[model samples]
Target: MFKNIKNDLPASVVVFFVALPLCLGIALASGAPLFSGLIAGIIGGIVVGGLSGSKIGVSGPAAGLAAIVLTAIGALGGFENFLVAVVLGGIIQLIFGFLKAGIIGYYFPSSVIKGMLTGIGIIIILKQIPHFFGYDPDPEGDWAFFQVDGENTFSEILNTVNNISPGATLVAVMGLSILLLWDKVLSKKGKIFQLIQGPLVAVAVGIIFFVLTQNSSYLSISSDHLVSVPIPEDTASFFGQFSLPNFAAITNPDVWVTAFTIALVASLETLLCVEATDKLDPEKNVTPTNRELLAQGTGNIISGLIGGLPITQVIVRSSANIQSGGKSKLSTIFHGFLLLVSVILIPKLLNMIPLSVLAAILFIVGYKLAKPALFVQMYKLGWKQFVPFAVTVFGIIFTDLLVGICLGLVVGVFIILLKSYQNSHFLHMEDVSNGKHKIKMTLAEEVTFFNKGAILKELDSLPRDTYLEINLLKTRYLDPDIIEILDNFSVKAKERNIDIQLLSKRGVIENPSSFTEFFRTRPKSKLSLS
Candidate 1:
């Protein structure tokens, strides 16, 4: 890790700039003490980073859990009680890691995973727009369609436009321009350009703008436009900040419920981050999902103990890390150190940097997640992959993240079943034997209940008085329901005076009287088509 410190240090600095405001924003959203987010960020960087198998993935208090955290804190009656749940949630996740439940992450379709990243990117952009303009009614990191404060996401945007702060807007525009120039122009310059990141440049411009606007009467910028890191009056006050859980509340069933909720949701988000980060890795290194769960679990437990928000493998910070050229865990560790050092040495300076500048930073992060090119690329992969991917995207955008994913998963399964039905048995006319019309029915491999409709249609479509051969040799597994359908078809065949031959592991027999009964008489091992 020390070997790449030169490269990683710069990357860490970029990630630190990005992570700082988000730490505060997410803490505000979680309804925990403002410093809790910082604690989680520190733990995510230091603890999770140190233990994690992932080289580039960053862990932090995720926006995805803000709603749950807010509700849990309320239901548990206090932040301290919620802390207990967070710790318990971590222990549960650790158990999950030991159980090897992380394998589930690998099963998600690549198209859906890509869509998730793209969808999140789009959401990040939409969410940061208000902040960019200095309208921050919701916390800086909230990313839901409906905010915890009862405002619809789109409605909040309209409200922000109407109530836009001119000073904040000016700072935001300036910061954005600086960031754009640094990336689009300066980055192309020479060794010096590569040494300084866009976020750092934008931040410096933000600080200078703050100084220039010190006289609020003359300038559009005001104190409200500035970044607001929680200020502790003294060292003693900072130490007094930590909250202890109400052990009495731990007995409440609701506490346990909240714990399970955080455990499940946090685990899911971590798995998603692991998947998304692997895609962003230039080396194409795979992250160990189970180990990631363990790392997250340990981080969350430590965070809760220290009165911090729950931690997860958060994509926002991780993506920022990747975009900034982070190569290893050193960047993550350094960013954590930065969090600790910033609060101790430069809390006042942090408070002076405008919120709009941080919003500009998030705006870039969001753009990277939801770029339009991602949509076009996914569509080009074909409908089988695209439909589910689109569904997940819309589901997340229109509804909530989990709901959208469930909807997409359901639609994806439905399509798979439809395809199976289409590929299953069908009727075909064979050459007439001595003018006696002959028909053939071919079964698909691994026939299941999903294929019953197609099989029935083919069976019913046979011409009356035609000789039919029902072939089951190719089928690997036969559904009992399908066997019943064949039984009924055989009875109907006799009534229609249709001649039929049955082909299976059993000797080829002509006009079997009872399809189900005949199958029962055959040896069970021999009858299994596979």
Candidate 2:
């Protein structure tokens, strides 16, 4: 980790820039105190990042949990009460880790995972569009399709058209231009360019523009449109922001319910993010999921103790770290330190940076995650893979992250069932003799109820006066429903003047009196293939 400090330090700065607005915005959206988000960010970075097995994945106050936090805070009656739930949720997550439930992350299909990254990318792009144009109704980091402000994503974009701020638009365009130039041209020139990334330069340009245009009414960006970190008047007031959890709420059943909810949701979101981050990791390092859960649980416990919203491994910050060339966990830890120091020391300077600049940086991140080429690639994999991927993307866009993933999982499972049904058995026509067909049916390795319909269809469609051989010699296990199907089919075969040959490990039976009876009564006997 120390060996990559050169790469990690600059990357941490980029992640810190990305995390700052998000921390504040998520807190604003969650209806929690603004400082709470920062505390979570600080803890997520330093504590969770220290304990986590992931080298690249970063943790923070997640936008995914904002809605849950908002609801829980209200239901629990206050932020202090909500803190109790957060602490308990951490304990539950620790239990989850100890139980080794991290294997749950492996169960998510690759298509859905890709779709999630793409979906989140698209969400970031869509959500940032308004902020790019200086529309400030929604906070900087609110990524939900339906916002707490009563407007949806697209509606905000549309409203931004009418309420566009010339200053913001100018700054955004300049910010984007500077970023593009830095990425494409300037950054390749020398070590200096590489040391100073595109996002940092874009931010510098945004601040300079803000200062220069202060007197120009049309070009001056409003305070609301700028990055707003809570300014503490003094050290005491700053420390005053921290609140203690209400231990009295621990006895409340509703607190336990909320804690369980947070644990379940935060754990799930963290797992999903871990998957996404590993996919994004250039080195392809695999993070220990169980350890990540333990790390997150610990972080959440500390965060709750100090009046912060729940924390999760966040894809946005993680992706930023990767995109900005973060090589190890040091970047994650350094970013947390930056979050801590910046708030303590240079928050006033941070407040000068415009939101449009950050939006510009995120636009690039979003584009990389949901590149148009990825869609084409997924489509080429065929509908079996594409459908779930597409559904997950659309679901996340129209609904939310977890809902979209569930929808994708459903589609993925449906595809699996369809394939299983089709592959359950194979039919081969041997020859035609005396106007009669000899058909051999081979059962798959494992036959389940899903395969019953396909097998039944084939049995029912067989021509009359044919000799049918039912081969079960290769099948390791068969569902009883399939055995019942064969039993019923034998009766129908006799009516159709079809002769039946049943071959199994129990030997051959020609015109067996009863299929079920033969299987039940016959002892295992090896039959020669010859």
Candidate 3:
């Protein structure tokens, strides 16, 4: 892990910047103490990161869980009671780990996964546009469509146009220019640029701009548009932020229900993030999903004990880590330490950084995730894949992450069934024999119930005085339902004056009375093509 400290350090710095606002914003959204988000970030970074099998994934309080946490806190009576559910949730996740439930992530269709990545990218871009123009209406990191703020997503952008801050916008533009320059030109110039990342410089510039223009009437940035960390009066006050769970609440049935909900949702988000993160990883390393669940469980248990919000693997930070050249878990662990040390030692300094500058940084992250080229590429894969990908993208944009993914998955399954129905059998016309229509029908390999409609339709459409050949040579497995269809077809053949010939490696049968016996004699459930 230490082998790439040089790389990890810069990457960690970027992740630290990225994770900081998110921690505060998610807490604000969840209606938990501002400090609780920081606690979750610390634990997610150090404890979860230390144990996770992923090299590039970063764990923290997720915006996705903000609403759940908000409701759970209320439903459980208080934040203390909610903490009990969080701990129990962690335990349930551990149970999931032992049961190897991480495999659930693999079941999501590829098109859906890709759509998720692109959808998140689009959301990030859309959400940050207002902040980019210095229109900070609500706290940062609210990824939900309906925000605690009175406005929804698109309305916020319109609001930004009317309320753009000249000073903040200028600084954001400068910050963005610096990042693009560093990425395209300066970073390629030498090792120094690589050692010090563009985002770090942009943040520093933002801070300097904030400090220098404090007294200027026209160009001043205010506290409302800056990173907000809880300012403690002293060391004693700093430690006061930590809250212990109300273990007595465990007896409440609602607490148990909340716990199970958190466990299931958190695990699913983690698994999905794990898949997304691995795809973003430049090395293409596959994370051990089961191990990730165990690690997350442990992190949640610790977080709840200390009053932190629930945690999960977050794709935004993970993607930032990978894009910033993170090579190992060191970047993840180091960023946690940054959160710990900075919140304790230099929170005042951190608060000086402008949200506009951070928005500029996220602009880059978002653009990379939802590039226009990806749309064209997905379309080229054809409608079967493109429809799900497009639906997932739009779904996430319109709805939340989970709903979008579910919609995409449903569409993917429907497409699969439709394709199966169409490709189940191929009908070909051979030369007519004795003025009767001679048709050959070939079955596809691995026929299942999905294929029954197509097979039945072809068999039923046969004309009277037709000579038909059923070819089973290419079929590896036949469904019992399909066999029933063929059997009934055989009975109907005599009334229609249709002649039947069955062709397989088992040998040709002319006008076989029963399709069942002919198939059962050859193999069990599978046809013996060899």
Candidate 4:
């Protein structure tokens, strides 16, 4: 993990800046004390990153859980009660990992996964638009279409025009220009540029701009436009930010329900992020999904005990890490440490860094993920692949993360079924034999229950007095549902004066007695079905 410290060091700094406002914003959205979000972010980074098998993936307080956390805190009684659910949720995730449920991530279609990445990218861009102009009406973690502030995403953008802050807009523009110049030109010139990341430069400039413009009424950036980390005056007050969970709530049935919900959602989100980060990795390193669950479980347990929001592997932070050149887990851990130390030591200084500057940084991250070229590329792959990708992107933008992915998966499954129906069997007309039509129907390899409808329709449509040859020469692992259909069709053939024949590597059988029994009793064959 330390082998790439030079890369990981700068990457970690960039991720830290990217994650700071998000951690605080997510806490604000969840109605939890702002410090709790920082706790989760810290644990997710240092603890989870240390334990995780992923090379470049990062974890923290996730925006997707903001609604659930808000509702859960109210429904479960209080923040302390919610903590019990979080701890229980961690235990449940641990059990899920042990059960090897990580394989669930593998079941998602490639199109859906790509859609998720692109959708999130679009969201990051849209959500940050208002903040980019210094209109901080809603917290950054509000991923839903409808906002708690009584506006939808697009409406919020419309509102930004009336509320734009001149100082923030100017600083944001300068920060963005620095990022573009550093990325497109400066970074290529020397190792010093790589060592000192563009985001850090932008952040420093934003702070300096905020400090210098404070007296200019029209051009000055206010505290409302800056990052807000809880400022602790002394040692005792610093420790007071931590809230311990009320373990007594563990007996509540409502707590259990919340626990299960958190576990299920957090696990699903983590798994999806693992898949996405692996795709984003330059080396294409695969993270062990089961290990990731265990790591996340541990992070949640620790985070909950210390009064934190539920934890999950988040794609935005992970993608930022990858885009910033994080080559290993060290970047993740370092960012966590940075959060811990910065909040404790320099929170006031942090608060001076304008949100618009961070918004500028995220704009770049968002564009990279949702690049226009990706749209044309997906379209070129045809509707079978493009439909799911488009649906996922739009769904995420319209609904939320989980809902969007579910929509994409449904579309992907429908396409799979359609493909299966069309490919179940190959039918051809052979030469007529003895005044009867000779029909040759070849079964496809690995026919499943999904193909049952197509196979049944073909069998029932056979003409009377037809000579049917059911060829299994390319068949392997045929479903019993399909076998039953074939067996029933054979019995019906007698009344129609139709003759039946079965052909396979085992040899041809005239009028097979029982298709179900035949497939069930057949010995395993080493012979090539292809």
Candidate 5:
């Protein structure tokens, strides 16, 4: 983990900066105590990072689960009750890891996965727009098109435009300009630029801007424009912030429901993070999914034991970690340590950071994820891939994340079935010999009940007064359901004045009246009609 300390340290710092505001923002969004997010971040970075098999994936309290957390907290009666669920969720995740459920992540199509990344990227960009203008309504965790506070995303942007704070806007613009300049122009110019990371530079400039505007009453900027880290004046007061969960409510059935919710959402979010982090790795390191599940489970358990929220491998921070040149898990671990130390020791320093400046950094992140090029590329892959991809993108943009994915998955399955039906042997046209139109219907490798509709359609559509040839040469396994379909088609074909030719290993037979009965007890063979 420490093999690349030189590169990793800088990366850790960048991730640290990116993670700080997110930790606080997610906590605020969850309606949990503000420190809960930081606790999760610390645990995710230190505990999960130390245990994770992933070299580049960064873990934290996820914005994706903010809705669940919010609802769970209210449903369970308090934040403490929710913590019980979080602990149970960790236990469930551990079992999932042991069961190897994490392998499900491997089954997603590359196109769909890419679409997910692109979709998230677009969401990040859209979400950060308000933040860039110093307008924070639902905090940093709410990224959906419709916010929990009943405001449309686009409308919120319009509202933010009308209420833009001049000081925050100026700092944000300057911060963004510095970040872009450092990344696009300076970073490539020389060693000096490489040494000073863009996000770090942007954040430092934001802090200085806040400090300079401090005493100026005439300045439009106020303390609210800066980062709001909770200040603990002394060592005694520092430890007083942690809130212990009420363990008496642990036996409630509602706790279990909340646990399941967290487990499923956190696992899904973690799987996405794993996939995304893998893509972001310049060296292309593959994180073991099962191990990652275990790591996340452990993180959650530890976090819940303390006063923290449930945790997952969050892509936002992971992507930032990679983009900033994080080379190892150590970078992730150090970032967590930084969060712990900063909040306790140097919160005043952290508080000087402007929320708008942080928003600017995330805006860049969101833009990269959902660039227009992603759509064009997906479309070029053909409709089979493009249709599902497009559906997912639109669904996510219009609705919530899970709903959009379900819609896309449903459409994807329909397309697959359609393709299967189109390729079914029943639809293939064959040539005729002599006066007999030899319609050769080569059964599929595996014909099942789902192919019934296509089989019936083809048989009913057979031209009248034509000889139809049906070949079961390539068929390895034909389900009983499909056999019934063939039997029905044969009867219909005869009535339509069509001749049916049957070919099998036994020999060639012309329109056997009892074709279905003949194959009823047919023994399975690798080369059935070879």
Candidate 6:
């Protein structure tokens, strides 16, 4: 890790700049103390990053969990009581890690996951627009469609247009232009551009702009529009900001319920982020899922003990780290230290940076995540993949992350069922001769109750004096409902004067006495077509 310090140090600085405002923003969104988000960021980087098996994944307070945290805090009666739930949630996550439950991450469909990334990207872009324009009242990290401040996403943007800050607008435009140039032009020119990331340059320019325009009437950026890290007057005040969890709340039934909710949601969010970060890793390093859970659980435990929000593997920060050239966990660990040192030694300096500048940085991040090319790519994959992907994106944009993913999963499942129903069997009608029809039906490798309707339709349409052959040559598993459908179909066949032949791996049964009996009588060994 030390050998790569040259690479890791620069990457860590970029992540620190990226993470600073977000830490405060997520806290603001969660309705928790602004300092708590920084606490979580510090622990997530130092503790979780140190222990996690992932080389590139970054952990921190997640926007996805802000809604849950907000409700949990309110329901638990107080912030201290909510801290109890966070600690218990950490314990539950540790148990989950021990149980090897991280495999659940693998179950999410690629379409849903891609949709999630794209959805979050679009949300980031939309939510940042207001901040970019110097409308600072709504808070930074609140990306939900319906904000905690009672305004929706579009309303916030509209409101920003009405109350635009000239100073902030100028800073934001300059910051964005500098970032775009650094990324598109300067960064490619030499190693210096690579070493000093665009975000850092943009932030520096923002601070300089803030200082220079302090006395200007129209161009002055208000303190409200700047990055607001809790500045401690002294060591005592800094330490005083930390709150202890109320252990007595542990016995409360409501606390347990909240704990379980946090554990479940945080675990899920972490697993999803792990998968996403792995995808984003240029090295393609596969993170050990169970180990990641354990690391996150430990981080949450520590964070809660010191008045912090719940921690999870955050995709935004992780993606930012990856994009900034983070190559190892050292980058993650170093970012944590940066968070710690910045809050301690440079809190006032950090407060000087404009929120609009940070918004510009995230704009680039969001754009990368939800590139138009990706949408077109998904569309080209066909409706089966695209519908779920589109639904997930729309759901996330309109609702929240978890809801969007669930909606996408439902769409994805429906597509699977539709395909299964369509592919259950192939009906080939042979030439009709002498007032008789010959039809051959080949069953799919697996036939379920979903296929019954299509099969029944074909059987019902059979003409009188027809010769029908039902082939199960490739079938490996047949549902009982389908078997019953075929059994009932035989009676209809008899009424139509159709001669039925059932062919299986065992042998051909001509005019079977009972379709159910034929299948029941056959040994289990004969069921395999192989």
| Candidate 3 lDDT over residue span 151-214, tens digit each | 7889888888789898899999999999999999999999999999999999999999999999
Q: Over all chains combined, what TM-score does candidate 6 have?
A: 0.96
Q: Could you give me the TM-score of model 4 versus the true structure?
A: 0.97
Residues 42-153, candidate 1, lDDT per residue (tens digit)? 9999999999999999888888888888888887788888888988899999999999999888777676677677777778777777777777656776777877778877
**Using Cα atoms with residue i matched to residue i, what is each candidate's TM-score against the true structure?**
0.92, 0.96, 0.96, 0.97, 0.93, 0.96
Candidate 3 Cα lDDT to native: 0.92
**Greater-TM-score candidate between 5 and 6:** 6
- What is the C-alpha lDDT profile of model 5 across 1-530, one tens digit per residue? 67888777878888888888888888988899888899999999999999999998889988778888888899999988888888889999999999999987776666666667777777777777777776664677777788878897788878887877767888899988988888889989997777668888888888888778877765445665566677877877767777777789988999998899899988987886687679768899999999999998888988887779889888788888888888899899999899988998889888888878888888777777777887888788889999888887777777766677667778888887887776667445556657656565777777777787888777777678787767776777777887777677778777877877677765566666676677765634433344
Report the C-alpha lDDT of model 6 over 50-135, residue by residue, as the tens digit: 99999888899988889888998888889999999999999999999999999999998899999999998999899888888898
Worst 10 residues of 3 by lDDT: 521-530
Q: Please report, in order, the local distance difference test score of every candidate based on alpha carbons.
A: 0.83, 0.92, 0.92, 0.93, 0.81, 0.90
Q: Clash pairs of candidate 3?
A: none
Off by over 4 Å in 5: 217-220, 426-434, 494-497, 504-530
Give the distance in Å from residue 192's predicted Cα in candidate 6 to where it truly belongs: 1.7
Whole-structure CA lDDT of model 4: 0.93
Q: Which is better, 4 or 6, measured by lDDT?
A: 4
Ranking by lDDT: 4, 3, 2, 6, 1, 5
State the lDDT of candidate 4 residue by residue for 256-373, as single tens digits: 9999999999999999999988988989998999999999999999999999999999999999999999999999999999999999889989999999999999999999999999
Instruction: Give candidate 3 regions above 4 Å deviation.
Output: 504-508, 517-530
The 10 consecutive residues of candidate 2 with the worst lDDT sum are 521-530
Q: Which candidate number would show the highest TM-score if scored against the true structure?
A: 4
Question: What is the lDDT, from 0 to 100, of the residue 147 in candidate 5?
Answer: 86
